[model samples]
Target: MRTVRNVHARVIEAPADRVGALLDRIASDDDPLFPAPVWPPMRFDRPLGVGAEGGHGPVRYRVTACTPGRSVRFDFAPPADGHHRLDVEPLGPGRCRLTHTLQERQGPGQALLWSLFVRPVHDTVVEELLDNAEHAATGRTAAPPTTRPPLVRLLHRLGQERPVAVPVPDGARLARTAFDRTDFSDAWRVPLDPGMPRDPRAWRDVLPFPVMASEGDELLLGQDARHLDFRASLLVGERDVTLSTVVRTHNRLGRLYFGAVRHVHPFMTRLVLRRTRRRLALAAPAAGSRHRRREAALG
Candidate 1:
């Protein structure tokens, strides 16, 4: 059997004991390991020690040995013949490091699955976990990867589309209201809430370019920079909204930029949509009034 390995590590600002306490909390709750939609599959047949039964992700395994605030290892099954471990190493006083490794033996079929579907998702999620750990330790969010892979860059050059479905109350002015709350300029940099806008045209001053289109319940807004021709839209429905972004990479630079974000594109779309939904319902009346004023002006 060929042993395959995957590992992720991060330097934490917290002390060894504090980091270990965070790990213990994660083990007990599994919240950090598995966020919403990605459920943890640990079968705690016994306590946390050697021979205890549980599995991380899809690899079924039993505990090999566990040293509190230090290391915890698990042994896998036949197709996944190997082990996984999470270690907390003391870098020095007031500083520590965390490493999580998954080692398993698998055949051709398993390898294909891992390469195509599992690896990408796992990479993104693991990074998220590390970010969360850092946040828990220091109350600061970790910076994520700034670029995508080679293939993803090529795909970006050709073009790519991402759509997120977000549920919200349906109203006549929903589309405009949705746009009223959008600001993605610095979203890639830091965390900020950009909700429905009071004036769709207001974005013209904030963004580098002019307004693209602001229709009834559908707004197309973005800038066509030298790197890429980007257009983001809010397609409002009766009870839900589909936030979609289309990128037409202009040249190699555009493709490279797209490639950099391709991995995180899906999650970022969902996140923005989720954020938009929170303010959509609350701003319905304000949006309706604005829509009526526009109609009156046109008449």
Candidate 2:
């Protein structure tokens, strides 16, 4: 069996009730998570509540059962013999999580193919679907509000879409100023070097967010809603050093939000380069080494 997980976030200006109504509409493909048509167009009888059903399309299968705000199960045959279950659950105050599992039955070859090839495609599809749902639920593209609305509670429900986008910053160039004005002081120079103990210059990307390099040990990474105070330091180990990073979401929006918080270890930054260089150094003959005798004997 192969499993995939996806998350989406958006900042919806609307009230919780407004968002909930929209989410209820999105539960089935007839309403759709996104405005556009998706491939295979999940066509099933508009389930009254939830239970078992038979369906057909690119794959023929029996949808064994389903729960409105919980999960859906399908048993596939013909084009593919497998069983799939789509599960949804709440994450936090206003966030939800979706998981899909696919298992091949009766054929080892099909199972191997599923593990190797078919799995990734399913993962990508689920991710895209979730993102589209996030965009739609958040009222993301709505024009900036001239006046902020009174605080409203958020809803977290399975099979329901929620907003994930942060509000646009005040000025058009706000993001740029934050980048330029960052004070690179003792605070910025975390003792950590990027992922490995290689060149400190090489590991900035692996840090937290995208960063700007000022000089040798100096670097800067952008901030996000989850962790506006994101910071990192380096820890040296016997063989490999680790990047110790910290971030706090501090949900200032007065509501819960969902999003991935990417992190980078200082040492991980140079891991690839260090590993490659180490391999090359080892492969080359050492000067007057004990191994030389073995090499000479082999020759």
Error of 1 at 230 (Å): 47
- Backbone clashes in each candidate structure, one number apiece? 8, 21
- Candidate 2 TM-score, true structure as reference: 0.34
Candidate 1 lDDT tens digits, 80-174: 66787889999999988888887777788878877876666556556655665666666554575323356533433232122333333233233
Clashes of 1: 8
- Cα lDDT of model 1 overall? 0.54
lDDT of 2 at 222: 44
TM-score of 1: 0.46
What are the models' TM-scores? 0.46, 0.34
